[model samples]
Target chain A: MITSISLPKVEKKNDPSLAKFIFRSIRDAWDYRWAIETFVTNNLCRRYRRSALGFYWGLLGPLMTMITLSVVFSMIFHIDIKSFTVYIFTGLLPWSLISDSAIEGSQCFVSAESYLKKLFIPKLFFPFVIVGTYTVNFLFSLTSLLLIGMVLGFQWKLSLLLLPAVIAVTATLILGMTILLGVATVYFRDLSHILGVTLPGFFYTIPIIYPAESIPEQFRQWFLLNPFYYVIDLYRQVIFKGQSPPIQDWAVSIALACCLLLAGLVVLKRNEQDMIYRM
Target chain B: MSAEIQIDDATVRFRIYRNPSPALKEMAINLFTRRSSGEVLEYYALKNLSLTIHGGERVGIIGLNGAGKTTLLKMIVGIYPAFRGHVHVGGRVTPLIEVGTGFDLEMSGRQNIYLNGTLLAHSRQEMMEREKQIIEFSGLGEHIDTPIKYYSSGMLGRLAFSIATMIEPEILLVDEIFSTGDALFVDKAAERMLSLFDRSQIVVLVSHNMNHIEEFCNRVIVLHHGEIVNDGPPAEMIDFYHTHIAGRGSNASTEDRSPMNTDFSVASPSTAVSVQEQSRFSMTSSLSE
Candidate 1:
């Protein structure tokens, strides 16, 4: 049965250049796009599988959070109830998208050990699924915000057309962060725990519960330190204030998105082959 | 395109860290200390292993646990990276490494087919087209609509095997697929497995059942301590395995030697007779040991 067949000797291949690595990673992700879709849909369904409210739970969770924050902050801070509700709604939705992506993304690769061990799935796939799932939920809650704002006589602005762009940019930023944190958590195992403790602390810095204008003048520079502030402010500008965000806001968020994505991809390319052994 | 696998002195090394995942504080503390952090132990799963498998070949891998049979399949599947050398596979590989490799148990059987298909690189549209055929082949009937968590192990195996063999893969790598379905389902699975072996350009099957290996495979490779100890026809390799490997202080008993022994009912009479002869040969060899 053993035939002495002489096949041509294959040459040793060089490691893929960083640019080629990134390109191949993108190609692999594209090839598995349907898998990502299935994962995202599967995640969404399982989230509310037994819940009576089903898909509405995605909307109600954030809506309830916004309402509770609006009432308490209005009473304590003496802010206008109507405008504050809209303000918190805009701020809270994007914040949850970011936080959910980070916290859950940290666990994405770990949670997917079974799949990763058995197949040759790209490392980017799980992070995309994480970002994709939260992004869908974010869009659901965003829709509810728009309908509720119209009901409350919040003026509809032409700037609302810009919501998708802002959401896309924000989702990209979340994707980058999720990938970085997810891969990091796979190695350190404690970074996920650290993220849980520190991420809520970041919420206060971003001015989600309070108005950005309320920050004292001297501490204003510090708001720029939190990357979420730029993104959340972009959402607030379009959804709550009915105006296009300043060029600096767009520039900052977009830059953060690119930087995080590049960092994530580089880290992923470096360790992807070895991650399974660690897991 | 012809399917071929060429592995040139490939080595797979795993680092067994003392603290596989150290906390941030421990890392920070270690950075300041004179002592190196946690000790690292490097283990080679596959060392300088080289083999070539061409199209139109059914290769069977046999070895003890931790002998790197699955590890080699994984390296060929591109799951485990070759640490030192290169592994070149000329075509797309479809691996049946385990039952339900990417299954979402919370999902219904129908949904799982789509999920598994996509994981195997099939598009949603492709899955939609093939979903009915897969369901029909599995014969789950109305139960396809219910969550797969309710599926018995046998039912899960049927669905997994059906989805995996939905299309003729260029290279089919099987690592002891656990298909413990009813006798009827097993018969169907056996037929499918034989057909898959026929259609796939290259099939690498890893199993302990020498009967299956002798009956199905033309060639066999024996692995020991991550190295190829022998490679030859199934008859020669099976005799080598029974006399030298399995018969010497190995825990494999006559019954333990053949996990697919039950499938003899469906096998050809001559094939079943050969299996009996193989078992008798193993028994005599073990007695001499």
Candidate 2:
């Protein structure tokens, strides 16, 4: 592995082929697996370090958001729908996973200035840590939502068996986006600020608060263009809607994730060496 | 399968930007106007440097500030990629540069031990095995559970030092992290460092301390303005470096003399002794060794 040994790892000026870049990257990640584990643990620990509620806050925060949004839309706005709390809960959970991870991941390299300056850490390691930490948090909220949804007269379907696959696809999508944004943010520090402003726009436009059908028929095609909508829809199909999504949806979601991941790897490979000096 | 490092015709250039990164607004404006958003001051940090260190060579690198001393160490560590030429390293490199650098302040001293161990690419089980030794050496005791942010600088240094030294390095790279902890801890650290040096196949030490170079290194490379000015035995290189580089540079300005003199007293107690006279004693002793 590249991280384990220092020899045969020549530092040259030319960029390697994409296949070479990916192969070496995976080896580096595997070699630094313990680091990823430690960073994720530290990240989660730091989040709840001084909080009185601790890990319970992870469960309660989403529950409280579901309640507030359900009350606002169902009771106040009177936009009546069946199992509305569970519906929004399903949508908001995945949406938060994507947006929150992206916002944090965009600054992963910039924030790791201290570590990067001093060691030979794999460039992909930071984004992997972000994705790992967020996925754990996502799983926690998912468990709470499942119990709460069941209590609210929502039926569980065997389609829930597909939830793991859905999460894999979504997490893959987030990891790709995180790596891409993280590398870009190193060269352009404004990318994180841009994400802060634009991610909320994504939250509004991606139909997280309302069902996809709620969009007017003329403007609905734009929703199909969004890469995130497919991943979120995959979750809603399995968890909230209690039905198996079409194979085409699965194909599209997986393909989108693979493409982003490829792009992210490409950008990272090209800029990996230059990134240290840029920082 | 001994350790080796070959840096051939390597040129590491650094670009210092007036604005490190361009803002989005500035980027957009530059795109429209076809204007450069910032002025870049580019220069070579390591200029056409070619050097090779084989197994069992305890090499010392010495130079004035901005002479690419640390840059050379970092380049070999693969932290700084060369802009030109090739750098081929032939063993596991363990850089002791900024030992406690990436410690998470919010984590406890014990937790940081594992965190730092993993960062150095040691496995969890490996760290677990050394956990007792590390904690005992750090001497943080019950304070190991408390967040490291609350620890005094000396305590933090001790913890960082203990964790960093717990490695069986094949090619050890040291960059002046010697002066940590109190007198007692420094003695312990120096002993540990000497043993580590003895075990490594290749050792490259970068220091302004002439005494350390004379004592520990068999071979010495004197870097001047990113190029190797002299490469020879430790005593000879130290004498050449002091007269040609440090002395000339110091005479040009007094600010450069302090770093060369800071650790010079360990070699000789008398302030009246000249650098040449001090090196002459070591020349005879090192030749005999």
Candidate 3:
């Protein structure tokens, strides 16, 4: 069948430059950008299509979880209501991006195998769609976090200008992990299952619920090594504590993201052609 | 406006795992413990097949069930990496293999037009501009707004056929997609396909229906076993295919064994480069992984 069959010109170029690959990958994904946006919107709509609140249901899930954890943990620790909500807000929203993308994006390649077999779509496309869908929700939650802080007389500092940079670093880190897991899951069926069990375990270890101060001094140094510590800590500082992130924090975040992304791209490039056979 | 292809002695092999999916945990433990989780079989779907397709050529591929018709298409599309040779396609190539394959059944047929369009490599604006024409041609009318799952299979096929034939891109490769819709719609589909043929620089069709191939193709290739057994004029090769290739299973008489003969032959393609003497597009590194 011949539906609008325009294709990107393919040539056997010997020893392609790294920049060429980057351009092609981005271009391939961009060419299918409409399809990606449609899927993302459909996913969001389908989740709450039958609900009375419609798209607002995206906000409710995180809001409800945030409320439940804030109430229970605040009561247990005798923490102030305002400060407790801020902690959960800073940590949980970003944590949801990582967790949701890891768990959902793991199945992305496996689930979209039919399309891969049919069209020469880039393997990176599905991960972008899954992460993009969740990132929209993450943005919504982030907006509410700022709104609440403003209502509570929280200061908006010049450091707030750095939020987009933080977001870029955060998206790069998760997008790398999500794409990596997406590829691995095509070969390993239980990857999403492993993710389902390990994410909660990973969460408790990250000090999302409790403050960094609650950690024993003996274990504090090791906690700093968690790449997410920098991300979550940066969130808290800028949002709750109203301080700019240190240059070292920015450096480590970007460097780690770049490392993971580089490795992820290599794995994707090697495995992409074989994915159709596996499926 | 042109597609130049040279597949220099390509061999495509598939490693079919015995297990539906080997448990990753067990595979990992086996790696550590030096044990095999399951048996795997590696076999060639296409072996040492070489061909050159030039611009403005219409080649039709006819073969039996396991004769690598689909694999050949995938090899050119670069989905199935060649194990031992190079597949150099110098032009944009559009594949119509497996029509409506990636359509989301729950989405409306109208929305799927955009999704399917982009998958076929058309941009959003292109789909938008042609939306009315596609709807009118598909004749789905109001049903286009309804979920595709609700549409009857004939209606679905019609929609797919309509979307597929909406535009003609360079180097179109079609596989047995023309014979599905209703009789009148099939006529319309055939008419549209003929128009695409006129516009496309080169077209490769793989269909079991010999009549379509006889009418549309200028050149025909009969694939038997894994290699091209014959390549020549459509009418003559098609006659050779029926008498020899297709006749082999039903009848029990030995026929001519020459490469140029109308019967199934043991001789290899004399035109192809020998495994020793490498062509320009020779595979240097093994793509075995």
Q: Considering only N, C-alpha and C atoms within 3 Å, which residue pairs clash in candidate 2? A: none
Top-scoring candidate (lDDT): 2
lDDT of 3 by residue, A202-270 (tens): 898787878889999999999888878787777777777778878988888898888777777777776
Worst-scoring 10-residue span by lDDT in model 3 chain A: A1-10
Instruction: Kindly list the per-residue Cα lDDT of model 2 for residues B1-289, writing each as its tens digit.
Output: 7888998999887665557798988889888998776556555678899999999999999977667777788899999999888899999999987677667777788888898899899999999999999999878899999988798777887888899889899999988867777899889989999999989999999887789889999999998777899999999999998788877843435523544423321211122234334333322322232
- CAPRI-style quality class for the chain A–B interface of candidate 3: acceptable
lDDT of 1 by residue, B9-125 (tens): 998866656677877788789778844565655566787999999999999999765567878988998888887788999998988775456677778889889988998889999
Taken over the whole model, the C-alpha lDDT of each candidate is 0.80, 0.82, 0.75
Please give, for residues A169-270, the per-residue lDDT of candidate 2 as tens digits: 888888899999999998899989989999898788888777788899999998889888888898888987789999999999999999999999988888
lDDT of 1 by residue, A123-145 (tens): 78998999889899888888877
Task: Spell out the clash pairs found in candidate 1.
Answer: none
- Kindly report the fnat of each predicted structure, to 2 decimals: 0.53, 0.57, 0.39
TM-scores across all candidates? 0.88, 0.90, 0.87
Instruction: State the DockQ, from 0 to 1, for candidate 3.
Output: 0.31
Model 1: CA > 4 A from native: A1-13, A71-78, B24-35, B250-289
